[model samples]
Target: MFDLVIRNGLLIEADGVTKADLAIDGEQIAAVGLSLQGRREIDATDCYVLPGAIDPHVHLQMPLAGMVSTDDFRTGTIAAACGGVTTIIDFVEPKPGQSMLEALALRQEEAKNKVAIDYGLHMTIPTWHANAADGLKEVPAVVEAGCLSFKMYQAYEGMMLDDVALLRALTAVGEAGGRTVLHSETGPVLDYLRAEALAEGHVEPIWHAYTRPAPLEASAVHRAAELADLASCPLYIFHVGCQESVEAILQARSRRIDIWGETCPQYLLLNAEEHLGGPNGALYVCAPPLRSVEDNRAMWHALAQDALQVVSTDHCPWTFEEKQQPDFTRIPGGVPSIEARLSLVHHFGVNQGLLTLERWVEVCSTNAARWMGLTRKGRLAPGYDADIVIFDPARIKKITPATLHEAAGWTPYDGMEVCGWPRTVLLRGKVIVEDEQYVGAPGDGRFIPRRPSALS
Candidate 1:
């Protein structure tokens, strides 16, 4: 008999959903058909059984401005698992003198014993210098060690790469059979704007949006896309929040460039106006600060029109106390969204008719796995990993900090009610979450080795 079976559920996939039963043997799907038999079975009537969501962008235990992000691997992956996200791809930052391979080893060590769900890493180059090319030349070793993507920043101080550095690194990564992921924003302009805002005493949280305007992000996207094209590299832009950025991505794709764009829940459902509310507004502060309602509408249309291909949380949670600073620029900028991401997408996208169930799964899970070269993941079929979510479509859960698993102690989406919730979550046929309670061990998660995608 199969190890486990889920019966009487609507199986949701990228192409469509089917009323079927699923069987799992060992850690992989053993069968997907009518009336499957197993040693143990779950009654999934009135629910949707989807391949577990894959959050491609997240920062667990990230260090920023002298304070570490509150969500360590244990808590962050617990939140991910409880929310039906079985896999997360987080960044691996190489110190100034550290080789990419060294950074990957250190990052893997950090997550190996703490993450409660499956995870992967994206090697990130913090800065470029005389030995930058030499450091990147080892990218093939890192990719061979299981990380197929590299990240470069064009925004943050101490992290931003010059155009020369970005082009060189992209070329090296492309030559290494890896993808180049970027954080697109003009760093100097943003620095100047922040100084201007502070000099004029525009220190409120709302000024965060004014300092890092949409045009700056768009210009950076255009430049980065051009560099990727010139280098003949595959590019993936993360946390794109504005229409102009989307336009830049589309314009590149128009020329047959291999480029993919990602936008987060904050960009899709929240607005910059939230920063005008009060002291609490600082909680909404993040890089590529939230944009206008027009931008939000444009993002929904773009996702529907296939102009944008992925929706990740970019989940970097910090505490409320961490965000109370008068200097908007100094406020720890990241919002807690992991626990509510899947439910919010279901409520707003599928339930509201903005996206079909198939499209929702594609953007949240399938596309990420495919783009990241997670070959056996992001689908619900025989031989695929049995990471699955039993979602109760009729359940109503209002988002609240007290109910969340992120260590941040607050949620930007507090008071928002979502229609669907993950009733059960399984990682490779082992139940990690059931009835919203975490039932997994700290080291239950395993490291996922990734291969280079053909997009390169």
Candidate 2:
């Protein structure tokens, strides 16, 4: 007999939705057909059975500018469960001169007994100098250890890499059959602009957006795409917030470059005008700050047209106190969206017809699974992991800090109305969330071993 079955739900997929009953045998989907029988059955009439959402970008317990993010693995994964995300890929960031292997082991230890859902990690290469190449020789070891992607920053002070280093790292990773993801923003230009802003006494949150203009991002993206082409590597751009950057990415793709673009809900929904709302606006401070409304519309169209492959929450949450600094630079640069990502996307994308239900599943779940190398976790087909979400499309809720499970003191999308909500969430055939309550325990999550990417 099967372990459990969900009956009569419209199963959403990459192409369309199908009415079927999904049976779970142990930790995997055993069957997907009409009238599947199991030891236990839950009726799901009128609900959409979607593969559990996979958030490919999240920062749990990340340290930045002398402050650690408020949400640790437990709170972060719990919030993810409530929002229908069964698997998350967090980054393994190492300090300058720190061994990548040591950082990976330490990060895994921190998340081992704390996370409440399945997780994978992307390793970050902070210092990629001439000497750094010898260190990166261990990359293949970690790729064998399940960390298949590497992140390089082009903007942040300590984490940023020079173009030479970036090109070399990309070449090495490409040769190793791995993917390279980049945070593309020109550090020198940003430094100059920030100094100009500070000298002009324009230190407010709004000036943060002014300092990092769209052209700088586009310039960096253009340069990175060129470097990826030269290195013969696949590129993944993170937090794409402007049409200028999208145009750059599209141009690279037009040349037949294997590059993927990722945008977040803040970029797709919120505009730079959010920065004009006084000190409270500092809550939205993030790298590659929110962009124009025109860019928002462009991001929506890009997703619908298949130009952008994934939408994730760069969910690095800081507290209200941490964001209350007088200078814009002192304000922690991130916002919490893990709990609101799927809802906001559904409310804005599918409900408004900017995205079809199938595209919704694709961007939020399946595509992420494919891109991040989570082969078994992103589909509802038989033999896939039984990570599922029963979504109620007719449900409506106003987002509020009091209602959210994130440890951040507030939400940037608070008071925003959303239609669809996850009614039930299952991780590996085990119910983790029901009726908006988290039923999973700490350490229930396991590290997912990912295979090497085909892009290389």
lDDT of each: 0.88, 0.89
lDDT of 1 by residue, 334-384 (tens): 887887888888899999999999999999999999899888889999989
What lDDT does candidate 2 reach at residue 52?
Answer: 95
TM-score versus the correct structure, for each prediction:
0.98, 0.98
Total clashes for model 2 = 0
lDDT string, candidate 2, 1-456, tens digits: 679999989999997789999999999999889878888998889899999999999999998778899999999999999999999999998766777788999999999899999999999987643246486787788788899889988987767888988888888888887888889999988999899989988878888898899999999999999999998878999999899999999999999988999999999988877554554888889998998899999999989998898999999999989988878878889999998888889999999999999999999999888888887978898889999999999889999999889999799888898998999999999999987788889888899988854222
